[model samples]
Target: MYIEQLKNKKYSLGSYIPIPLGFILLMFFNFLMSDGVDTNEVIQQTISMIGVNLTFVVLVGPLAFGLLLVLFWVKFVQGQTLRSLTTSRAKVDWKRIFFSFFLWGTITTAMILVLYYTQPENFVWNFKPEKFFIFLILAIILVPMQTSFEEYLFRAHMMQGIGLATNSRLIPLIVTSVLFGLMHIANPEVGKIGYIIMVYYIGTGFFLGIMTLMDEGLELALGFHAANNLVGALLLTADWTAFQTNSIFKDLSEPSAGFDVLTPVFVIFPILLFIFSKVYNWKNWKEKLTGKLIVTNEIDTVANDSKL
Candidate 1:
């Protein structure tokens, strides 16, 4: 029914197709037009010249604006509400959003602390009081826009659009997950670690998709994503990483897609899902993940809108 709600919206595979294409075109055009910012250029000099805080905004701003454009289209053109885009519940669940945020935020931060202490030599305390404060303000405001854009595009819009088009839960789940990973193929991590790290990216997609589907909403996924990026931006900055920010510490280790990356995908994600299932009491594993998406014609008389 959550997926079926898209039927009432101005949503079709065709309609949804152009959003990402336009986003990609806009990014390319911006890249070409922006002076002295080269995607292919040396990473350190660019960061030094551009300033870490400004560079962080430049990398993330387009996706954030693109998400705004999509939200506008969803509201005006599609005649759909943000609550509908977010969840099947009566309204957006802010509790679920922050719950998932702090839950994963704790786990992620703890892991980073362990790594930091275990290999202190690999991390440089890059905290400049003034610079970090500025970076903090920008990261708090802008990082969510970046993470939310990905979640909305992949888990909210594309997941629903692809499900409606294919009329199957499994296909959309897989397609959107893989496509989400593919979207990050150009990230600096890919260049540093090679395509071998795609396993981590694609695995992350699968985790988010599973969370979105099983939770029957994007709240959990949104929180998890925001926490993941937000914590990373605040705790660590790396030359080869995407969010090259003036965070508390800078990673100087050689980047690799070894156990640190693979274990999370194969082990930690499943553990987190299991914990979520227990807490949320999620059942119907087989049906929910791979079931047919039947359109429900439930009418919400109070809101004067139809629900699926």
Candidate 2:
């Protein structure tokens, strides 16, 4: 039983409790530290919010709220080694990450290209070499923080918590996937594209969740996500997109949902999944994913004694 694995594996719930709470406190600290304590400081508020999120990403490992929580669970709670936390003791698969990064990157770039070709005048072609290079450097440093923060929160902390709580794979998968989508509701893209685009956002969560659950570790998901955001932030920028930092290209093209929108959700995602499944030789996914976690007395007995 998967739940039994939690106990037999010495997994504990205490580690999960503080991470989300700590994140909330960190966010409050960010809000309090922001400049101008007024009703309408939009720019300041935005900067502070981004700052808080990125800070959380950087601290996740050190603070045990993000990737750190996963490490804590494997190391202290489960008494497992570091290799278990990172790769589930399996070989790191670089091809999976590369295939996903390029595949998704090309799909997004193609959409921008089509839009640009159709409406050249709409796009300013504002490529300033110096500014764009500066943006690239910032992205190399910060976007990983952003993507890692979200992944650690959703896939690492929340996924593990729900998996332990419900003692079933399906509930955690659904809960984390939905929560991950909700977390992105505040991004500027949502307003421009309307709530309909949430299907894509939430769908991406589901896809990532499937990857995590199937892989039994965050390595592939981490690589894929880091690559996705890093490439996107560096490759193009649009007026409507959030994080309007300098990039190699400014998307002068108007954004709209087309086959481009559906390709990732409907096509690329499934292909990536198939690719991973084959590479990992993932078997009995239904069992590995949806099976119940049966908590046993063996590990819990010792865990309970530790409290005394």
Candidate 3:
């Protein structure tokens, strides 16, 4: 039903191409141009030059613009309401968003604390009140924009686009999940921990995609993502990570692509999915995720006039 919201004739492939294609090309070129350069060194140098907060703005600000772009395209080009782009419900569900955010935020913070207590030597107290508060403000403001841009692009927009074209939920789920993973190929984590980290990234995409399909809304995905990035930014910073922020702690451990990488995808994510499924009362696994989409004429008309 969420994907069927895009079944209107106004939702043309040409309309969908430019924004996502431009984003993918930008990432590809950034990866290509940074091929031989030491990305960590570059990040360090940039942080040194501009400080952590400004460097974060430099890195993440465009994604806010990207979020605006996606919303604009959905409204003007596709002639759809923001609600339709986000969910099939009568309105956007703020309660679901907040629930998912609080749930994941607590889990992530607890996990970080467990690690901090378990391996005290690997972490340093790097919390500077002045710098941290500044970074916190920026993280609170910009991090959601960055995460929301990704969710809207990969989970909502591209997922619906691919589903509209193929009429099969499984194809879009797999394609978007893989594309979402490949989009992060240039992250410093990949360079630090090797390509095996891709399993986590791709698996995260699958997790989020499955969540979107099962929940029939982006609220859970959006909230979970925002909380994950925001909490990570506030709590920890590592040289090998993408967001090397002025956080409460700094990781000094050697990066490894070991059990940590596999655990999330293989263990924790399935558990989280189970929790979300139970909380949301999700059903019809065979149809919501992998079955053929059947959009009646009435659904198409309603989708078309959603802007009215």
Candidate 4:
């Protein structure tokens, strides 16, 4: 039913081309700018002048770019509603958003505590009253915008568009997931932990993708991603992490592929999936994930045949 909405003439597969075309235009501008001045230098210069806590604000840049383009294309070009882009439900469910946010936030905070207590030597208290509050304020305000951009773009916008283009659920799921993961290749974590970190990134993409498909919406994915980044920025800090903010604690140890990384990918993610499936009353193990979307004339044909 979610994918079936693509049958609207305005959302026809042909209109999907503008989504990538817009992104390419944005990328071209980014590249042209990069040729003249080192973007990293500009960032570092800004950080040196504005203090490192504002780095989170700086990090929101690319997400902002992606968000603007997607919003314009979806709203103007495709003439789509935000509710349709986000969910099968008639409205955007704020309750579901906060529920998944707190659920994953609690789980993530618990996991962080487990690691800190079990490996006390690997962490240090990094709290500074002034700096942390500033970081918290900035993170609270700006971080959702960052996470929202990613979820809406990769999970909602691209996922739905690609699904329409391919006329199959499976290809879009896999494509968006891979793109989501590969998009993170520039993250500092990848450099610190190597490609093995991709397991977590790609696995996260899969987790989010499955949740989207099973739930018939992006609300859960939105909350989960917001919590994943927001809580991490608030509770933890590390030099190797993308968000090297002033957090309550700093990870002193080097980045590595370990239970912390693998457990979520292989263990906890599956458990969460099972829980979500039970709660959402999702049926059809094979069809929803891989079935061909039967919108357009197929429904008309069925209706006509039933008249006999």
Choose the strongest candidate by TM-score: 3
Residue 191 in candidate 2 has what lDDT? 60
- Model 2 scores a C-alpha lDDT of 0.62
Assess each prediction's global lDDT (C-alpha) against the native: 0.80, 0.62, 0.87, 0.78
For residues 21-50, write the lDDT of model 4, one tens digit per residue: 566566566555555454445555666888
Q: What lDDT, from 0 to 1, does candidate 4 have?
A: 0.78
For model 4, the superposed segments whose C-alpha errors exceed 4 Å read 21-49, 296-308
Better of 3 and 4 by TM-score: 3
Candidate 1, pairs of clashing residues? none
Best to worst by TM-score, what's the order?
Answer: 3, 1, 4, 2
How high a TM-score does candidate 4 get? Answer: 0.86
Model 1 worst lDDT window (10 residues): 299-308
Better of 3 and 4 by lDDT: 3
Candidate 1 similarity to native, TM-score = 0.89
lDDT of 4 at 115: 91
**Residue pairs in steric clash, candidate 2?**
2-293, 3-293, 3-294, 3-295, 4-294, 4-295, 123-252
Error of 1 at 144 (Å): 0.6
TM-score of each: 0.89, 0.71, 0.94, 0.86
**Lowest lDDT 10-residue stretch of candidate 3:** 299-308
lDDT of 2 by residue, 113-139 (tens): 776678677666656787676656666
lDDT for model 1, please: 0.80
